[model samples]
Target: MGLYHFAKSLVYGLLKPVYRMEVIGTENFPKDGGVLLCSNHIDNLDPPMVGITAPRTIHFMAKEELFEVPVLGKILPNINAFPVKRGMSDREALRKGLKVLKEGNVLGLFPEGTRSKSGELGKGMAGAGFFALRSDAYVVPCAIIGPYKAFTKLKVVYGQPIDMGPIRERKASAEETTELIMAEIGKLIEVHR
Candidate 1:
């Protein structure tokens, strides 16, 4: 297997026993075409948890600082993780994300831009909505609900793809689309939490 799949399998093997991770609504994922997986972040483990559970490989836009870490910096790129500067527009990162989707790959993103300290879904940034409107990819909302206690259940729930047709046709602003995405994430958390 390739590095990404190998790492995913390894993580799954290790985390499954400890967290009793349960994945729901994976059937909601499309089998092919570009897909944007917009999820709410809660813990440091959120990215890997969602990556392993999703049916397809997810290329993530991780914080740029993560790339400066010693060993992890080298490993992240190999596992399909790229760096994105937070708290700014970061056009380069946005371009990279668009490129990933344009190539018909799955691009995983945390719409909230950072992890929540209180474990509640926070306001989403415009990035998720921007990508959805810019690309023809299916925008799938995901929720990672967990206290991440060992031997306890941690759930990753994938909600149905948000229909961007009407929004697109109406030429809705990215902020509006972001609100819709965050709302969908909230609903998923409500059902699965």
Candidate 2:
């Protein structure tokens, strides 16, 4: 297997029993074509957790600072992660994300931009919406509900793909599309949490 799949398998083996992870609604995930997998971030472990559980390989946009770290810097790209300059409009990162989707790959995003310290859902960023609209990919909303304490139940719920047809038809603003995405994520959180 490739590095990404190998790492995913390793992580899954280790975390499944430790977190007692329960994943629901994975059926909602499309098996083919490009996908924009958007989720609410709560902890640093969120990205890997989501990646391993997802049926398809997910290329994540990690913060640029992470790439400066010692070993992790060299490892991130091998595992399908690329750096994005946070707290600014980084055009290069956006282009990279679009490229990933355009090639029929799953591009995972945390719409909140950063992990929430209080574990509360935060505002959705326009970048995710931009990707969704631009790529015309399946926009899948996901929620990771967790305290992450050892042996505790951590649930990852994948909600149905958001219907982007209307939004595309109306040529809605990215912010508006982001609102719809966040609303769907909120609903998933409500039902699962």
Candidate 3:
């Protein structure tokens, strides 16, 4: 926990001024337990931007390419960020995410898979759904209002965690589960937009 705060302060100290972040709905964020912080991607800095806003430590899953860098590879892991293979069925990524949740840490995910080109939100993929089912972690839906630009008011609105009661009771199929998760995330994002 100390490491997390130290790393967060280091990052925020260096970048917060350059971004001039304006956070909202921070009161809605839970302060404990395993949580899934889902957000829309706008730029490479999106993960750090979203993660830093959480009062608790929030680790994010980034692309495997980031790990290839010499200095960053060493440092990113220390800050609780790791890489994932793109265009592959990354069970390893999913497992890592589940592990993070099971460890009672926050797992930050960009369900859109990549950054938004038109600065418009994309339909969320099933990665979030898989993580939810595997670990029983609550999904805390988030939205970033102005990440395309820099040093501006980029709002992060956190919606209430989802309820999977009926879906689990119904024994929802994978597709059903994925769609359900996607819909809930979409609805949350829409609320703040």
- List the candidate numbers ranked by TM-score, top first: 1, 2, 3
Please identify which of the two predictions, 2 or 3, would achieve the higher TM-score against the true structure: 2
TM-score of each: 0.98, 0.98, 0.87
Question: What are the RMSD figures for all models against the true structure?
Answer: 0.7, 0.7, 2.2
lDDT at position 24, candidate 2: 97
Over the stretch 1-193, how does candidate 3's per-residue lDDT look in tens digits? 5766787787788777777676777777777778887787777777767767876678888889888899988887888887888777788887888899998888998888898898777766778777776676777777777754656666766777778667666766655666666566567667666
Candidate 3 lDDT: 0.76
Q: Alpha-carbon error at 185 in model 3, in Å?
A: 4.1
Distance from true position, residue 147, model 3, in Å? 4.0
The local lDDT score (0 to 100) that residue 156 gets in candidate 2 is 95
Q: Which pairs clash inside model 1?
A: none
- Model 1 lDDT tens row, 1-193: 9999999989989898899888999999999999999999999999989989999999999999999999999999999999998989999999999999999999999999988999999999999999999999999999998999999988999999999999999999999999999999999999988
Better of 2 and 3 by lDDT: 2
Please provide, for model 2 over 1-193, each residue's C-alpha lDDT reduced to its tens digit, 9 standing for 90 to 100: 9999999999999888899899999999999999999999999999999998898999999999999999999999999999999889999999999999999999999999998999999999999889988987999999999999999999999999999998999999999899899999989999999
In model 3, what is the error at residue 9, expressed in angstroms? Answer: 1.1
Worst 10 residues of 2 by lDDT: 127-136
Work out candidate 1's RMSD over C-alphas. 0.7
